[model samples]
Target: MNKAYVTFRDQKSRDRALAVLDEFRWRKSTLTSKIAEAAPDPIVKAPEMPVTLSFDPDDKTPVNEKVVKSTTPLYNVTYEEQLEQKKKAAYSVMRKLGNEMAKTNPELQQFVRFHKLRRKGQICEVDDIKASPEDVC
Candidate 1:
């Protein structure tokens, strides 16, 4: 076993020890504050660039490319892309509904055929089928 003994010979020695402790405390506080003041502020970065997308049904996968338009932000581009996706989904639902209607209404079939012919650059009549008022009810 080991024992250590600390002795203050007189009041003067005790006062000197206290003064050293006080100086050490003051140094520590000043050093801490100095470090805090010297610390640099955090850095902020700009958001990512905007993207423009094109849908090609023929290809197995979708293609996307980044576009840098003047006066347009990334968030706006993303929002526009979302709206375009929604429009595409709505069109898909409309086509499905048209196909279902073609079972009962031969007129819709002719309209669909007409659109196909028009897409192929052939001259076609612009006849659109309308449901009878009674059928709607």
Candidate 2:
């Protein structure tokens, strides 16, 4: 039922509404308290080992000397280096295209320069490729 009685006019209706609200509040508080009381207590920690049994001299061992070499050259360049190379390649291509466009039409020189300068820094840092240039603009 909707608690908001918009059309209630008489004094009796208002008194009854107030009583209902008080009962609702009382029931909510009691329910919350009961739930909290029934909740599980914080977990207990395990006991620590005795001093005599804690450490052993025999447990200490030298590091392994064996080394394994891979046959494939797959990891010659790391993922980060590869991503950097790709970004550099992309920006280089963008610069070349902008240079050509500016040369072909002198009217577009300012626009091409704007495009080139906008992507001067780490182009790969931005997630949105299209908006990267617009951001600088």
Candidate 3:
């Protein structure tokens, strides 16, 4: 049988380790609470109510694409094109948030393993990773 030896430099080193552990615990709890708070509340059933639907043939109107094109300025864009632009903008924002979180959060960075995993073509889910300040130590 083989025995392993373990040692701490002094009382201060032990205290520091304990402090780091406590901080990690506190941060984990805080993250849990924050996640819970951010989650959507469960839906509850309410008393059922009768609903009515009505349609009128006169209300139906066809969109005039030619008229729309004539009215739009040469530089103006369509709604579908604008929506695609917005989606790209939102994606960029999410990527920026992920980068910022990776920079600030060590546990998240660990979970991401950005240096190792990025090379392997793996990406982290931003919301799933929790980081603690003690991770830096």
TM-score of each: 0.27, 0.33, 0.29
**lDDT for model 3:** 0.51
lDDT of 3 by residue, 1-137 (tens): 22223356886775666556443544335211111123444442232444566556675445575456557633377556665666556556666666677788766876556643563323433332223455686
Best model per TM-score: 2
RMSD of each: 28.5, 21.4, 20.3
What's the lDDT for residue 107 in model 2? 94
RMSD of 2: 21.4
Question: Which candidate do you rate higher for lDDT, 1 or 2?
Answer: 2
lDDT of each: 0.49, 0.52, 0.51
- The backbone clash count of each candidate, in order, is 0, 0, 0
Q: Which window of ten consecutive residues has the lowest lDDT sum in model 3? A: 30-39
Q: Which ten residues in a row have the lowest lDDT in candidate 2?
A: 30-39
What is the clash count of model 3?
0
Q: How many collisions between residues are there in candidate 1?
A: 0
**What alpha-carbon RMSD in Å does predicted model 3 have with respect to the real structure?**
20.3
Q: What is the lDDT of residue 23 in candidate 2?
A: 38
Better of 1 and 2 by TM-score: 2
Write one digit per residue (lDDT tens) for candidate 1, span 18-126.
5664435453352111111233434422234455676566765422322333333344455557556665565566556656666677867887666645644222332
Tens digit of per-residue lDDT, candidate 2, span 1-137: 22332335886885676556553555345211111123444443223433454445675543231111134333567666666766667767766777778799899888766655675732223342332243565
